[model samples]
Target: MTQDLYRLIYLSRNTIPGSNENIHQEIEQILAVSRQRNAASQITGALMFNRECFAQVLEGAHDDIQATFERIQCDPRHADVVVLDFKPVEARRFSHWSMGYIGYDTLASKEFTQIQQATGFDAKQFSGERIYDLLHAHLYAAEKAGSGLGKIA
Candidate 1:
């Protein structure tokens, strides 16, 4: 990957239970700062929050992305962050947004219940787009997550 092309991949798990809505407020603040800085200059990526975990891909200046993620980690709203991957990208997979994503609380309802009912699977082991799928089913797009990438990306 070119030096100019770097991506920060990480995860965001919520720390506060029953704290879905508050995460949205935090994200709005983040977006405001990012936009004020110029969306095209410092770009973050996408996020997928399983009811239990979060995953993300961030793209832009290496230091900026990492520092931003650290801020998110310290945010009382989330925790248990595992940075599964980080490095240069041959190309951008989720390159379209300034910061695009959803929070884990997106699954705090019907679909999570159904998954629990159907698979008897404890969410801790779930992965991939599966969590996002559940969130999509239960929440409105607005409630799902707009721009903050929910710290996952």
Candidate 2:
């Protein structure tokens, strides 16, 4: 039988206090480590951060998703970690990416501004499906445009 597939979406406030360059470097480190670990675990996901908060969607086996999320909750760099959704999925939306990253630079200033205005970096203001849709749309646009802005795979 095929193993069950699941998707977990979450939001967290970023607690990585530093200058812009330092923050970027820290995020890079996170992506690097996440890419390796997620790939090893056969997990696929997308991560979006705007220095103030983080929104991510992880997909894999139920146990794997749980373990990964547990680690995320324990991570010191993230505060007020909240799981928006967790349920069985029919298929992966981010199959090509072990841990695709979408930073502030990946989106246009106007679009980013609109998002900031709407959510104000508040986790409570967004839903899991909203976060997933935003990430998926942006990733799709980036790929279509050949921007390579957030393609970590």
Candidate 3:
């Protein structure tokens, strides 16, 4: 039987109540763990941290994605977790990545400028589909260059 695939996208505010350094360190740790866990579970997606908030897309088997999101919801590092979209998908959008990532440094780039215009520069203003589009752009770019995520310029 073909494995069923699902996609879930969410937005959450960075509520790591502490110093900026602590928050950065925590995010790094989360990325490291997510990469390992996602790869092992055959999940793929992208995470975008725009200094103040996070937008993440997860694609995998239904149970895997659901369990992953549940774990994310329980994390105290972020709050107000909002599920933007969750539905069955025909294919994985970020197949080459376990958990690709992008951060604030790409904010000034022209390619990102276009994405911002399309998805709204402010995370709060983005729709679920718009966020997915932005993440897909970074994912495809990373794959084409044979590089990992977080390298988008």
C-alpha lDDT score of every prediction, in listed order: 0.54, 0.81, 0.78
Task: Show model 1 residue runs off by greater than 4 Å.
Answer: 17-41, 103-153
Q: What is candidate 1's lDDT per residue for 1-153, written digit by digit as tens?
A: 447667765555545456656656765665566544435456656555555555555677777776677776787756766664567666654444555555544544445445545755444444434543443333335434453233323
lDDT (Cα) of model 2: 0.81
RMSD of each: 6.5, 2.5, 4.2
User: After best superposition, candidate 2 residue 106: deviation in angstroms?
Assistant: 3.3
Q: Which of candidates 1 and 2 is the stronger one according to lDDT?
A: 2
Model 3 Cα lDDT, one tens digit per residue, 58-108: 999999999999999999888888888999988887887788887766642
Best by TM-score: 2
Q: Which residues of candidate 2, in runs, are more than 4 Å off? A: 108-122, 147-153
The collision pairs in model 3 are none
- Model 3 is weakest, by summed lDDT over 10 consecutive residues, at 107-116
RMSD from true fold, candidate 3: 4.2
lDDT of 1 at 64: 71
Instruction: Sort the candidates on lDDT, descending order.
Output: 2, 3, 1
Off by over 4 Å in 3: 1-3, 108-125, 142-146, 150-153
Worst 10 residues of 2 by lDDT: 107-116
